[model samples]
Target: MSFGLVNVPVRLFSATENHDVQFRQVHEKDGGRIKYQRICSIDGEEVPYSDIAKGYEAADGQMVILSDEDLGSLPTRTTKEISIEKFVPSEQIDPLLFDKSYYLEPDKTGLKPYVLLRDALEKADRMALVTVSVRSRMTLAVLRVREGVIVLQTLLWADEVRKPEFESLSEETHATQKELAMASSLVDSLSGDYEPDEFEDDYAEAVAKLVETKIEGGDITETPEAKGEESEVVDLLAALQRSVDKAKAAKAGGASSSGASEAAQAAGGSDSGSDGGSDGGASDESDAGKARKTAARKAPAKKSATKKAATKTAAKTTAKTAAKKSTTKKAATKKAS
Candidate 1:
């Protein structure tokens, strides 16, 4: 593609594709492929492919017939060259603007120019805005280097993107200091590096498996509807508290397990020698020590809870004794009188 004074002979490739299972309509009774014939409504007759021609309907319902020759003769820019308008900072473009991505490979002749541009763009941290005609549509796209390959990310027109204006946000909504702090804590607890490989298209996988099972003549089990753990809306504060606690507990549990594993390794390393029995004993003792330390840390809260329960019981008993003594005194005084 020619851009300004620089021309790069690069191969164009699609960045992504769909691997979804496709289904076709079939006659249920005969198990034959079902097809529909294109028919003209006015004549009530089946139409051949050659009889079809593009037509546009006017506002008043008058059809404008467009001949194949007329369409082919129409003036349109079908340029193979991609000319760069300008380069801009990558941050200036919104992520929502990007629609599709395509990888560009450099030819032997364009290798030098392609590498120069790639390295230059990498240092400048910018994307080249360019206009390219693909599939007869003139689209705005960005050129940037990704993993040593030039990737062209096509963008949607400004008019295509919608503004996030909604009725709910018209009025102000605010959170209290404590709620905000708690929410932040919850976020922090769950914060981790995003590994894209960790995710999968579960529904697609299930469908593929279903197809395989049918092909193998195996019994297929109907999938049950997913059920949520929480059945009803809970108090906001309480729910946040539970979420934060669960996250914290999970983190602590993970850390504890990791520490135990490290400790065992360390203990084994120090005690390991000609005697395997000694090493095993040391590792077991190290684990026991960790367990005891964990228990000791939790002991204070448990003791405090037990003490409060005993104090409440004692107070109730003392109040009951005082009431009995007062009643006995009143009866004795009345009898003496």
Candidate 2:
């Protein structure tokens, strides 16, 4: 069934693939089936499933056995329906919160509602946060559209995530103004429209291909050694500038291709309108050329001076606050004496 208000008819399917190599159990010594023993940890005695009981360790090496009835007494929600609690910005949730994904399809009778939900979500540019019970456990998840399909992703609770305190990382110390600027430029250089086909698991694909080749009795050739010495960038500013230049070049290339397509389309339209006359063709060409030039002129600047100025102002303000704190501390010490 489709999920969402837009009700865009969709089938939920997996967006990711799992190609992990699988292994099976084997004999340990005499090439015979190896069996495992179910024994008690404390007594080292074999125990049957019926004879075993769940227990929790307490202080001073004490143990407390828990019965099935005791566990059943604990309150638990049993509903199987996916409960939609709220819709939050996709960015607001951490990527680490996501665990597993499942695709959703529109049921025959629910097609209209499904399509409605899909269209609504797509237009609003929002994601639905829902809770669903699966295998006796309730899970928090997000519902979103991917390639005209509805997908649900299970999320981990906040308590399950470890805090960043263990790393003891100071944001101020690690990210300097110069490094940040360079990193921002690098991000800008690499930024483009999201295309899933552009990325692939190279390692996994290479391994799979190699396995296929080996199965076909093909001989593998030695890989060539990598050449050229790696040079360290001494000038950070120069590196950032170079990255910005590369981004501008890439954008220009994309615009040029788009312009070419528009020109071709205009030529075809003019040819269809007239019986291949030179006057009509020339007029269409002139209009297409002007539109292309206008698009090229609209290209965004590589560096934003306003953003850089704002960062510098923030840094100065922080420095002033620290200086004031130091002065106040000194005045308080003198008064105490």
The Cα local distance difference test for each model comes to 0.70, 0.63
Candidate 1 vs. true structure, TM-score: 0.58
| Model 1 spans > 4 angstroms off | 41-44, 58-62, 174-178, 218-337
lDDT of 2 by residue, 251-287 (tens): 6556545444444444344444333333443444443
lDDT: worst 10-residue window of model 1: 270-279
Off by over 4 Å in 2: 1-17, 24-35, 57-63, 175-337
Best by TM-score: 1
Check candidate 1 and list the clashing pairs: none
lDDT of 1 by residue, 8-109 (tens): 888889998987767867555544556688999999999988889899999999999999788888766688777789999999999999989999988999
TM-scores of the candidates are 0.58, 0.51
